[model samples]
Target: MVKKIFYNSLFLTLLSLTSIVMAQKQYPINYFSSPLHIPLYLSGTFGELRNNHLHSGVDIRTQEKEGFIVYAPANGYVSRIKVSAWGFGNALYITHPNGYVTVYGHLKAFNPAIIAYLRKIQYEKESFEQDLAIPKYKIRIKKGDTIAVTGNTGGSEGPHLHYEIRDEKTEKPINPLLFGLKVEDTLLPIIQSIKIYTEDVLHDKVLEVKKKDHLFSLKSIDTLLVPAKFSLGIATYDVISNTTSKKGIYQLELYVDTLLYYQHTLETFSFTESRYINCLINYPDFIKTGVKYQQTKILPGNKLSLYNKHINNGWIELKDNLVHKLRYNVLDVNGNCSELVFYVKKDSSMQKIPLSPLPIIDSNLLISYNKIDTFCTEEVKVKFPAEALYEDILMKYASYPAPSKYYSKFHEIHNIYTPLHKNISLSIKTDTVADSLQSKLLIVRIKDDNSIIAEGGKYENGFIKTNINNFGKFAVLIDTIAPTIKPLNFKDKTNISKLKTLEIKITDNLSGITKYKATLNDKWILMEFDGKNNLLTYTIDNKILEGSNLLKVVVEDSRQNVSELSFELIKKVP
Candidate 1:
């Protein structure tokens, strides 16, 4: 008995040593620190659940609030700064001198120098969001400088610093924890469900591997079947130590009957193929239902990637009745791992679907229907052509109510969620007028749930087309939410020389702020308002106000929430 245990231990040690020697991991670490004062208090670890690309960065908790002074992780410069409402509200990009850029997202504000510089350029260009690429020598910075204050900004669900490190040349996002951010976590990863994706060209496709007794097995009845010699794909998520929360697995090593076939370690990845995530997972099947089934095989037309090490073909060439032993390891920052063992016996099983669609629904799949004008989840989107509201609303009753925009051509594109209902109604409430010309000539179509093609066609009137297909949400965006206003350093019936700049904050929940203006005694003043934060500021140098100046401010949101404030300020000439 003792000899058997000893040999098992020796075998594991040798295997570990072999993996270390054979598997080449380029730790993308450039610098080091314990992101938090005492250590790391990560509420969200790297590769956690997110809308896209697996959580790229870890969210360092701020003790339940914002205003933590954020410093540069390494020597870098102000490479980029993004100020927006929904995601990464106010973010700072600092490019290190060492061919890498450290990113800080969801910030409150930048330091004085950065603020002044940003405002100057914003006023000069008269635009809020302008991406500037300065020479590394131009926008320089030092380590430990208070670059930004932590806050709940952008697409943040809470107040935390969303930090990341990206390779300068390849621009691949690497884990900041790799750079020596001593996040004192001792927890090993948790192994969740192991999923297998079988190839299917007809109808829908999905399969699941569940655990029973001490072993994992496939679902008894499934339609997903693969042919002999045709490879398979596996999708799995891992957890970290000190937390059993599922996270992105660093690497998934595949062996066919103990013969190494493929190794996919996320040490680095290109931004170009990021969208291949849809292809990597069983996207269409996952959309129709909830869970995901990952496949190990890289299908044709899928330019995703295969960081293969041992074999030319990452997938195994199977024979009839091929029984294979598959092993997957889940690792954390310190390389501590948890192992999951499973077997795949060649079986041609198919998935079964009931003909009846889910008849009940919770809400319409709505996206970014509030303050700002979000076109198609992109920067500039067009929600007209009124036809999206009527007969063409795709899907039964699928809905993704998350209203956010993505960067794309023509301003932006605000995507709707999948439909979960038999039908839906798209209602629009505009402030003044819908661009009837554009809205009239526009044709509306929806990307349905089951089908990859955008279903529905040009419909008359403002009705969204409806169906039993699964297209998450429906939107013929005509602004409905109002813009909100917050005043900074307010004064009433007092001499106003004390405050040089009239700073007012304007924020819109949705379509964002379309237009904003501040007037003293009914006259225009030179001031800049960052629509991202809804902040309005008028430097006293631009326009002088006389005695008992009536300060009037008007703000309009995408839904056209016009808020006007009137106050009197007395100015004493120095």
Candidate 2:
């Protein structure tokens, strides 16, 4: 009787869990409503390929204007608020009881009540940017409540509202379309071309595909054959009902001879696994031409969870002389599907392939996968963890002249076109920095666009060590220049009775600005920083007096170099 009871309990628990999962999947469609009052249009879609991560939220078009009223989609409380100069500037998070959370980002301003609350905390903290969490019931909000006003803030390039729905417990973003948010998308996906790769027992070859207007034709008479081992990749994009912009396809499926071989969908993904996009698309092609081609075949080191059902890792073996029919299905979020059909024939030339070459043993070299790999020379050392790379690659190294401001030689560890799955350890030995100024040294990456980005480093045992996410040109640079501050709206000691805001622009040469503070009459005041424009604006509040008000501003860089500006100002609200 006890054993039977135990089995019954286990079955009940599983049944309960299954029911919960089904409900979570269905709740958004039934309960949630659109956050905007107008008909919905999208500027960016969820699961789109970004620079380093998949776009976590959808960008809603706001008609190229700001200050549109943003409403709450469901009944929830304001659970969190983040104020920043970049990345979802002035964002809000609301959690509902339906096991989901809704996020509204790139807001210009919250409702008056929430703005007052934020300002009180900003004054207390004496900082413009803040991250705050509110307890439940503290800010009660119902469905359709006006939460914020939409604008092009933070990293946004234009006026739009960034919206997201997330799993409350897992914190993973759920595609909003999974809910009932209506987006008019009847057009099908456009498949530009399909690439076929031939892999032999010893070598791999990339085939050149012929391009036509819409469909790609593999020319030459049929019956052309290839190696028994082969893979496929496709370049495609989708169009919504009335938009010229091309977005990512929602689903992809591959079939060989009427049998389902592989499938992937963009329903949801965790941020931790988003970087695997570097392995999902053709990384080298993206680096060279900035085009993203989704590889239908799964690579050996790709661990993304997007692939649903795959057979033989999406590889096809043309063993017999049978003709293989290939069909690819691409779909958008709105259920618009497009299909491409092609054929592949077993080739007789594959029989003349040469035998595999013998491997050469090298004690100092290692091609690594699923194990840590290390390389060292007289002046440099690099350690790549097992998970650092999506696939095994021959470690390459070279050195060149550093840029003008750098103190060490530029190390070309590997081509930046190669994508790394995780951060790898890099250490460079140099004696250019004196012990007194070691704290100001940093490893910098020279980007293809000639922009310098700081890769934080520290001095240890006569070597500057850091962890880098990309394989690129790197060198040690010293940041001794302080930030530059220039007043924009007013001159020094000028009378400003009509002006309502004091605007200034601040910038740093290298190792970007770390901290900034503003003071009025030797007391703290709130100053808003806009990172995209490098502008700081301080509004005239009660904190400023009538005449001869002493205003001071101080800014610090990552290297602790400080810049200060003090001037007298007059403010009068006429």
Candidate 3:
């Protein structure tokens, strides 16, 4: 009884300390206004699980249309503007006086003043993509000032404003909702299913789940009767008011009887640790079932900061035939919550299997966390550096027939489902390829849908070498074709008097475009490239003359295959 009391006291002390620390970290609520003019609705929320990182910001809905005016939420200065083909294209960063920075992404166009400044830099540098850090005094903003217009510029599927609030000092993203950015949300998070797994002496075993009307029950009730150790996970999501998009839960608390056994709140996280989301979920299950199940029990390798007050890493050990109550409390950012209750009892009817060493499939395996691991086969070799993986895993390797288009054999380094903290070096020998095609050889990754992504590699010795993070079907392919360039609105040597811009579509058949340059009358001109549409646009300005003008465009592929287009156009002042 005394030992139980001591444990309870320690747990309470940790819980109280967590609450106090959270309460002390305050923010300037009501200092910022809604970034959009329309009613606030969310397409994505902060802390949401994404492909390889947590969604660091909230995606504000813009009525499913582009060109909506986005405003400055607080008084700040434009810290930086990043323009890219993917990953938050045309994003703006502003540093405020309150030690906070606001980010606005997927913008169609900036304000006229800002646009002029950016265009000047683009022309000076002769580049379309740039990461510019502006001085604070150069561009100042006031609260509610129009900054930019929203669009689906980057990796977005639709029109929405990706907004974020980050700590200026730590550069860590904090939940924007914590700063009094209010949205209508009354719906509680819904729990769709639950999973339980056990790590017995024999090996790890997966337990089956039975679901009905959103209530999940364990199919292996007989296994729970045995006194053993187990862990749990949940498949749940949140729906904001007037939005059908499923979002991540903000907080989760697991309770044993009436005491809090474990708790995790999505308050803030570092940008570096964002990739740890893969370890936070049941990655193997997600790969097989296509459902994301957040593991309630922290893995031994997981280093995410969201978990706190964890008792025994959220793993419950059943030692006696006594019934224990389990409760799950899930909440949204708006404080709306849902509760789930269940019971577990120990039974001795289930027998425990004895432990035995399994036979090693290959003697060349290096399965240790302390040192770098290197695995190889006849056709392919992989080199994993120290700390590339969170824990030691039995690295799997296999080689099969390559696709009809590929020149080398298909190599599967491991399951694509597993996440890696760092990249692994992959090398494939190309002895089968003709010597003439060696210069055009490069590695390509084939997705499940048979789509090809060029993993640019260089030929060294007799092998094509490159760094890869995800494990999939990889093989060597040759790219002998040059990129294609065609004018979209005008033909060569034609009058473009009424046209306000020169637009060209650039495409590549094999390797993607590497570099492109546009020149007018043998002088460099700034051409904005929108990667999504494969369009290169040059707005007519003082740079163009009234008479017949020569425009030259040169595009190069990854293999240095170049294509050039030259045209003379007659322009008149409107």
Candidate 4:
């Protein structure tokens, strides 16, 4: 009794403290009229779609031009400056005293003041590609003060301002629209269709909606019964207020007979979980064809902590005459919500649904794979262990039974090691190939004539013997040689002074140069590599000494073969 009283009093005290924080510390919008003086149009609004993660910021349209002056939304100082090849070509981060960090990405160039500051450091470091983190006190700006100009840089699809605000402390991104930013949205969310899932797919029949175009109604359920063992996922998207375009849903709530089962609010999520978007949606189908289908499987392996926590959230057991009611509430950021409800009848004894005329799989064809970097295609088809792949965890295709044994020195099986038991040898059969074809095999291995360190052996149709193994780059033509450097003008033995710059033409026979480092007298010199030209050009920049120098150039391939050389030369100042 004493503990309960103590807890109640503490809760009330904390509640009073929370009320104070919600009032005085409001969003920072009092100073600036708008991030842009132009009619507030968004080329990409908050929570839009992207190739990977959901677009976190609102992209203010720049109206097709470079060098439109970008202003500071509030009084703040620069906290970070990062320049990269893919992400924000030129991005600036400013942290306000009121506790919010506004990020501006894909800028053409910083204002003169910021430019001078950045260039000085870049020259000091002698590198154009760099990330700079500076103290907030170093660079200050007032609201409406011009900070940079708009430009199509980095991975930007076009010229626009990719702006976002993150909590200074938590660093969690919040919807900028929540801060009273004016956006015209009034349309309600739209539901496309619903789907029912059962673990007894092999024994049960599926119920198809009799009609289309409108929400299907249920004929008063006399406690509709469905035998146990199944889950649910819906096919739906949200419709924004000002636009007719289809967008992702903001929130999802699952309830069983008015008792909440599961809920997930997109109000906040960490950036680390963003990669798990593959687990959140149908990753396999999404990769094959660029369409997203949200899966509602609540696999136990899923590590995301965003699921709504409640006793009844998203699970129902089958019982006789039990009417399982599932209510799904979908909402958009603008507060528009769409609800979907249905009754499940508890059927006696599990039964299989009739197979569709078209089978989901074909045992005849090999699943061709393709990629440039990162993942090596392990298998063509991946079947997860119930609710594993699409929703809870991204399952990788692993093969079994040592795949590399077929590779003999006389027989060219380039050191291929199939991914251990991780590879999936999907049993497929073909009539023409026959079971005898299993003896005929295609030997695959890591590139570069490397010996098979690990491998997998599998037979499809009892005839097609396939050797695949360990997940890694299969084609291993290791470029054991360094980039062949040819000076466009500088003769190896001759004095290299007829030129104002030293240009070393370099090329790797195989997996081209991944990195190159040059230095003069042990001091780092910036030499840019133009992959297209196969040239490493080092001009007589301001940093170069106007005297005798020893220049060293080293180039390495992706496989880590190094070719290095040093040149003794005298530089004459122009």
Candidate 5:
């Protein structure tokens, strides 16, 4: 047994060394200027832990409002311009000649020249969302040139600029701060709490941390008694000089008896590996307590590239009853660091206590992460892809009678605490309904708060099928209601050419809006759709006639429910 442990530790050490060498590549400093003219502060950090993914770039705060001029960082060509209702709403990508790419997202608007070019395409395509790739010679940019204006567009919660630097070839985002963009941060990271996991324990234990004289220690506990094999997790965050926002730490190192046992740095990571964040964090704890704890131990399927060093996958095994010193060092990108020291002793009387067996249900199935599997009940069927799960689990499932307003039984496939890496195909058998209403049938996930979220599905052979990434209570619900369209600025025949822009609000209660179109005098007009605000706006341009104009708008929901609004207005000015 001792020989096996030693060999495993040696193998891990070699792997760690190889990773360290791979991550030693130096970043060029001062090559790119700050995207904003004002002082830069962070609302979200690169590699920060987010829902089901790591934040790919830093979010630069915009003073809680929009319309700040965004400048080009360096000489580059506009490589890509993507405008959409969600996810980076108005994003611009610039590819430099030096094989690097800079991305600016969540912009309110692009400069006039770019807007003219983009509007031309939007009018041609008759679509509000577009992803266009510009030729290298078409739109060239120079350093410090005004490119865009910042806003809280897309999936952003507030006014901020999501900035990124990437390798042009690989398209993987690198930390923008590494390029010499600076933020004032002299404060060290705070160690909030720690969790100790033992091999023989069913539930891990959490301990709050207290600081004294610039060092952190466990509150009211000098030493902890644990079994032979154990691991650790920490809830830590950093703060900037002027902001109260808690940001992710840049680096974490764990030491056992003053020897480095594990370390991970927030450097560059691939987009494909971002979902592995579910494995890096204590997922169940996050779902339970809403606190994300970065676990020191690496899971079997966690292939994230952030770990630069580790020994035995960060599992420390005590061979004797001697008390061992454990230490954690957490640091921010500016090199401000905090240290926590504690002690643990191996329990000499410890024995392997067998874990209680999970309750055996007739429909329970063992799902493995390495292979695809399917589970079925009388009214429901689920197909899990090989990558859907992070580890093996004994799936617990149940079913209850259909609730009011539902067409199918309330099927409980699994608990929501466990996270899935990929979408799983789910098909639920529905009660007999009129064939005409089948088009309105869609699956809805019931949240813990009793709110229902639409998970659109298609009806096929008496079943409503959908692909879902979360596990929870789901049932078939019908949405026969069309979206509501309300004019915010002008109504039918009430405009006299004074309004600079026409605004309308479109919304749906159940199934979300899928498509919308606006036309003036039977010609397609460019109307920007903001899904977050459920508002569509069209700036009055040369497209409107001087005397009279007919405006028509059409919108549709996911269930094909349609809404239309038509109006006529006088435009006295050209």
Candidate 6:
């Protein structure tokens, strides 16, 4: 009785601490306005689970087209402007006086004054990509002032504006909805299915799941017979009104007989901790099948701040034969919730079931998550830094004969299902090749479908060395072919008087494009590179004279292979 009372008191204390932390970060609801003039409908929400990281901001839809005017949410200055071909292309940052910052991404064009200022710097640097830090006194903005126009730029998939609200000092992204930015979400989150794991998921793969209406059962059994130690996972999603797009839930709580066993809230998180999402879900299952099941139990090395409460890391240990009730409460940001209830009991008959024998692994193959370890053979060497893994795992290693085109044997360090938090140093020995071809040699990861992904590396002492984040089949390969450059518009010695822009497609076979330059009549001209389409375009301006002019373009690949194109055009525009 005393022990139970002590644990109850400790739980209350922890809950109090959590409440205090939440209260301290009280967000101001009326300080900011909408960045877009249209009704806010989110295709992606803050803290949504993405490929390898959490979605840092919300993606506001732009009615399936571009050129939507984006406004400043509050009175602030343009603190930062970054224009790039990928990843939040043409992003703008504004720092307000209320200790907050607003970010707009994937812009088609900035305001005229800002565009002129950006063009001056771009011309000075002779580069398309620019990242500038603006002073507070320059480019001041008022509430509802037009800052930029939305487009499908950077890594955006469609026409939308990626918006974010962040703490100015810490640079941590906070949910914009918490600051009174309204998104119409009136529907409850949908609970798809729930999975039960009886043992270590990596080694013993005894997983069972079933789906029913609001109630879940293992294999359709009325009461699940689980092992003494077990964990649970759920596959769920949320949806907003007037859109069929599925989104991420805001909060998930697991309760055991009315006691909170685990609680996960998607309020805010740091960018550094976003990669831990690999461990937060059933990674192996996700890699095998494209389904993501969020595990209720937390791994030791998973230090994500999403969890507000957990008892014994959410591992339920059944000591008696009494049936225990399990309940899950899933909620969206608008308080619409869906509940899942089930029952489980421990039975001695479950122990009688035959279990597969654990694989016999070499002692050195065992890797701990908190320590640095190295594994090497005669031809391959890999070094893993501390905290590289989320849990202890047995390192799997194998080698196979390489194909004729490859320079070395295919070294399978491990399966690609696992994820690494930190980069691992990989060194692979290669066969003797001509000195001229040494620079073209690099490591490539061979996928299951026999496709090759170039992992750039440098040749050092007959070995290609590179830092890789994923574990898979790696082999040394050579890339000698130059990038292909094809003109889409006017050809050599053709009339381009009516053409407003010159378009050319540049692509590389193995090593990706590294650099590209274009000049008109010996003067450098601006060519906007759209990497997604492998195209470069130069808008015809005063630089191109009305008579005969020469245009020269040079493109280079990562392996130093270069391709050049020259064209003569007659510009007789009326």
lDDT string for model 4 (420-530, tens) is 222333222212333443333323344345543322234443322333422333321112355676767676444555667778888776544667788888988766554
TM-score for each candidate, following the candidate numbering: 0.65, 0.89, 0.89, 0.60, 0.94, 0.92
Candidate 1 local Cα displacement, residue 145, angstroms:
2.4
Global lDDT of model 2: 0.80
Model 5 C-alpha lDDT per residue in residues 119-187, reported as the tens digit of each score: 889878888899999988599899999999999888889999999999998999988877889888888
Per-residue error for 436 in candidate 4, Å, reads 42
Which candidate gets the maximum lDDT versus the true structure?
Answer: 5
**What is the alpha-carbon lDDT for the whole of candidate 3?**
0.81
lDDT (Cα, tens digit) per residue for candidate 1, span 1-574: 9779557535643564356435644564446444335345677766443543556677887877989888766676787877654566677787876678777888877889888887777767655555666556566777777787888766677788888778778787776766677766555454445544333443322345555332334555423244433444455565444544456656556555567666655545566655455545555445655555455655443454535453634454445665566665545556655554555555444332335543434222232222222123211123333212212221233223323321111111223432111222332221233454223221123344422222222333433232322333333333344566666876667676777777777765444466766766675654554444556767676355566677777777534457777777788878
Listed per candidate, the RMSD to the true structure in angstroms reads 10.2, 8.4, 5.0, 12.9, 5.2, 5.0
Tens digit of per-residue lDDT, candidate 6, span 1-574: 9779557535543453454346336799888989999998899988888988988889999999999999988998999999888999889999999999899999998999789889888888999888999988599999999999999888888999999998999888987887889888877678777777766443223334454443334455657777777888888888998788989887777888879888887878898999998988888778988778888778878999888788888788989999998877777766666666678888665553455754745666777889999887779888889999988778889888987999999999878888898898999999999999999998999899998899999998888999998999999999999999999987998888888899999999998999999989987888988778888989888888888999999999989999998999888767
**Which digits, one per residue and each the tens of the lDDT, describe model 3 over residues 132-154?**
99987699999989999999887
Misplaced by over 4 Å in model 1 are: 1-30, 34-38, 46-49, 200-235, 241-245, 309-317, 320-322, 347-574
Q: Scored by Cα lDDT, where does model 1 land?
A: 0.54
TM-score of 4: 0.60
Stretches of model 6 off by over 4 angstroms after superposition: 1-24, 200-219, 352-364
lDDT of 4 at 103: 88
Q: Please, what is the whole-model Cα lDDT of each candidate in the order they appear?
A: 0.54, 0.80, 0.81, 0.56, 0.87, 0.84
Q: lDDT per residue, candidate 2, 341-451, as tens digits? A: 667787766654665653534444555756888888777889888978877776667787765767788888878888998899999876566788898888888887878
Ten-residue stretch with the least lDDT total in model 6? 200-209
Q: How many backbone clashes does candidate 1 have?
A: 79
As a TM-score, model 6 comes out at 0.92
